[model samples]
Target chain A: MRVVKKAEDRKNEILDAVDELFGQKGFDGTSTNDILEKVGIARGTLYHHFKSKEDIMDALIDRYAVRLIDGAQEVAADKSIPIVERIIRVVMALNLSGGSSEQIMEHIHKPQNALMHQKIQKVIINGVPPILTEIIREGIQQGLFSTPFPYECMEMVVIYASTVFDDDLVVMTEKERSSRIVAFVCNVERLLGAESGSLMDVMGMFGEGDESSRD
Target chain B: MRVVKKAEDRKNEILDAVDELFGQKGFDGTSTNDILEKVGIARGTLYHHFKSKEDIMDALIDRYAVRLIDGAQEVAADKSIPIVERIIRVVMALNLSGGSSEQIMEHIHKPQNALMHQKIQKVIINGVPPILTEIIREGIQQGLFSTPFPYECMEMVVIYASTVFDDDLVVMTEKERSSRIVAFVCNVERLLGAESGSLMDVMGMFGEGDESSRD
Candidate 1:
């Protein structure tokens, strides 16, 4: 019996194969023939789904964004979690560095892939802010936070976190990293008008050794 | 009497022409021939100073960095200005979106010049934090700020400002822009552990029309 996959599933299968190939061989090293041979798809079929290799990379980025957004949305929707904890969890869940996300980041940073990098940045910058804003708004209603500029606050937070935590963007020593985590949480507490030290528990999650309050 | 220029003066003259040409015609549009014609230099002299257009661009970036650093240093050294106002002035002096700075930014953002963009970003991410840190340290001594992580705080501040205020990175509606200005000042106060409204004067510089507190 032939296992007939739906068009969407077939498309996803191609993406998964290329994602692995890109990880192993990088964007420039991976050839279309490699993809076709790995996926066992005719050249026409592959072309039917994607115009070119770059198109395939775009699809992979979209797939990655969807997964990230879904993970963040799940944490945002968990009413059982406290509001501040929920925000921290949402941030942790969106850390796209350890696994396939790292590979995607590498691929986009290639000089020829500048456009792809821009597109992914647009997704994170424009898309992630609203999702975080929803959580911030929830905190505002509960009086755990208070800010009429919820959207802008979340935008500022996302921009700061994305840049500081983005290993590709800026490298930091262990001391610098730990210190930043402290500064980050301190400002975040003040940004939301939460009581001082309310968000300091985030340092524990970040494994920051120095927990001394800035006196 | 013929005014004989030294080698250094000739180099500066060529740089001035290429800078204006790159500003008017971009990195790609202006050719070596255009630079030669504009500067009235023989091909040998041009090649003697710069091997390629990219090398010329590197020189230009170096010059830009020096100018920016000098401007920020002057502001940082001026003890007459208040500490909070000094930070704001230093940031304003580093604005890369007007005059020659704007041209350099446009040239770097071109797709073919991704390497140039990365090089410039490296300068900003690594070079900028320490310069801002000096001012932050001054603020700490004056009892205007209370932060143990002064360098990290400055890093965070630069990353946020460079991204949000970078016209190329993120686009905001006019209202969104105004709100971000307010939010930026608000968080900066908290990050430095200054009084709640201590840095609100930055809003006046930014022409923030809507000063309503984000309650």
Candidate 2:
């Protein structure tokens, strides 16, 4: 007697194993056999789903892209969530704080995942602005935002922020970092056509240290 | 007569040559001979400056680190510039729009430079906060910023801005990007202890499209 794994289920198991191994040993360091060993599948079964190591990596990347887009898409579909909260949730969904997310992020950042990293960036650059545009549109309709070129404004804002404020790009001392956050938050209202200085209540109120203010 | 390049001068020349060649053709693509040929130096001359190709990369990275720190340090020394303006200048210095900035950035982001990228991140984390901290101290002296734990505030702020706002990490929809800029500008006054959102004017007005004139 033997267990017969469905094609989709078996493919997911292989992908999950590959994702974990890639995260642990990096794309270059891992081999097909390692993936096979982790998933305990036959060579035929492995090749049946993926053509090569790179193919597996591609599948893994595709999985991440789908999950990421799906997360944002779900938020976009939900009408009950406030625009600001939805924006935050959408961004937070992109972050890897729980469950398999840490593993996924670690795998993607590995040196061999350079292409994968760039691919993810491409998805972000091409995909994100439109989603945010919709949120901005909703805000505009609800009188929550007042921008004439909501989409263009968001584009410039996103480009500047995604590049310069990236921790990976520029390092700031504590004072500089705080000032930037303050500066960044203050500017958001204007970007959205809201009154200037209207969003200051949450500037420094974002991290775990601010637990005292949770109400 | 044979050219007699001084050791330090030759060392700088080799590093510069490595920077250009590496910029044009990434680490894997450029050979040692290519570096020697372009620099018009012999293999012996190249070795005298650096132990190997990787060594040349290391020297170039060290040079970039120094240049980067120098940019931040210059602003730190100028006590007269308004703190927010100084921060803007510092960001401006890092614009990567001219001279060696673009070359350095491309080279650093090449696949082989993943570790180098991480090194730059560490440098930013270690270096930038204190530079901004000095401004905060000044702001405090002038009764502008009010934070009991300025250091922690700065740390979280830097981590968020550098990471989240980083174009490399999170792609932005145009609307999202604009909102970020607006938020940043509006929050600075709050972070600095000025009247909440006093520095809001800088948003959408700062940073130049200064690339066309650069060589």
Candidate 3:
């Protein structure tokens, strides 16, 4: 008997294949034929799912955005984790490393795909602050934060982090990057009205372990 | 005596005309012919100074960059102003409002002029940070800032402020903008280790004077 796959599953499989191909070959370097060949899907089946290669890329971006948002939301909503740790965990969860999302970011950062870059930035700028704002509000309830402008505070933080630390936007030496991360966490603690050195633990997430190493 | 304008003076006149044209018609909409007619210069004279319309725009950007850097440098170097006040003053001087710089920024921000927008961003990313870093170093000397990463901190500040507060990058409501200004000043204070509420006065330069006006 012949086996059949669900429509959603087949679509997701195509996205997964394309995601890997994009990460490896970049968006420009990868063609629809490459995606079709990798997925072993007939041209008609691929066309049934996506109108064009750009359409597939758009879907991939949506998938990546959803994945990131879900990961962040999961960490933020977990009542079991300490709020401080949750904050750090939520940020860590959003870190793009060795993933298809990381690959997509790398691909779009290239000069040719500026439109793609802008689209991704729009998603982050609009989608992220609200996700982070929820965590800030939780921190406020827990007496960990005391800002009147919780959403706005998170907006600035998101914009700063999304742009400054965005490898595509601002290039920095590793040492320069490490220092910014330390500075970022220190100011973030103050921004939320938390204790001076409370969030310093996040340094290890960026690979600079311990405060003593900073000096 | 025959009228003989200095090369620099003639260059300035062409730039001034093109600046007005760009402000009025945008970079793409304003043609080289428009510049020639507006400047009342022959095509030969216009070509002598700038190879093309894009070249003129690049030159205008350079001039604007110099003007902003010079303005900020003057404020930063003045010993008469208090160090904290100097930081505020230097930022205020760089504010893009009601000038050729503002017009140029608006023109470049149009969707069709993404290249121009990127070029201007490169100028800011490369140029503005050092000028602001000098003020930050001064702040460190005055005991106003205690951060070890003064230059990097300033880089973060400039990047955040340049993008978040940039009128073109992110569209915001009046109320939204007012709140962001408060959050920005608050975070910047912490970023430099300045006391909370010390830099709140910078809000006035943004025309939102006094935090009390924020609802």
Q: Please name the candidate that would achieve the greatest lDDT relative to the true structure.
A: 1
**How many pairs of residues collide in each model?**
0, 53, 0
- Residue A8, candidate 3: Cα error in Å is 10
Q: Fraction of reference contacts reproduced per prediction?
A: 0.60, 0.11, 0.34
Error of 1 at B10 (Å): 9.7
lDDT of 2: 0.63
C-alpha positional error of residue B211 in candidate 3 after TM-score superposition, expressed in Å: 16
Write the residue-wise lDDT of candidate 3 on B1-215 in tens digits.
Answer: 33468889999999998777777777767888888788777788888877877788789888877876776677777888777767766665554453334544555555545545656666676667787787778778878777766776676677667667663557788787767777778777876778777787644644544234565
Candidate 2 on A27-104: residue-level lDDT in tens? 767888888788887788899988887788778888887777777778777889867666645554554232234445
lDDT (C-alpha) at residue A30 in model 2:
84
TM-score of chain B of 1: 0.81
Deviation (Å) of A206 in candidate 1? 6.2
Ranking by TM-score: 1, 3, 2
User: What is the overall TM-score of model 3 with all chains considered together?
Assistant: 0.71
For model 3, the stretches where C-alpha displacement exceeds 4 angstroms are A1-64, A95-100, A205-215, B1-64, B96-100, B205-215
- Candidate order, DockQ descending: 1, 3, 2
- lDDT (Cα, 0-100) at A139 in candidate 2: 82
User: For each candidate, what's the DockQ?
Assistant: 0.39, 0.12, 0.32
Runs off by more than 4 Å, candidate 1: A1-14, A21-54, A96-115, A202-215, B1-60, B96-100, B106-115, B202-215
Per-residue lDDT of candidate 3, residues A1-215 (tens digit) = 43368989999999999877876766667888898889887888899888887788789889877877776777778889777777766655544342234544555555444445555666777777788888788888988787777776676677677666663556788787777778788767766778777778644643533234566
- Tell me the interface RMSD of model 2, in angstroms: 7.8
Candidate achieving higher TM-score, 1 or 2: 1
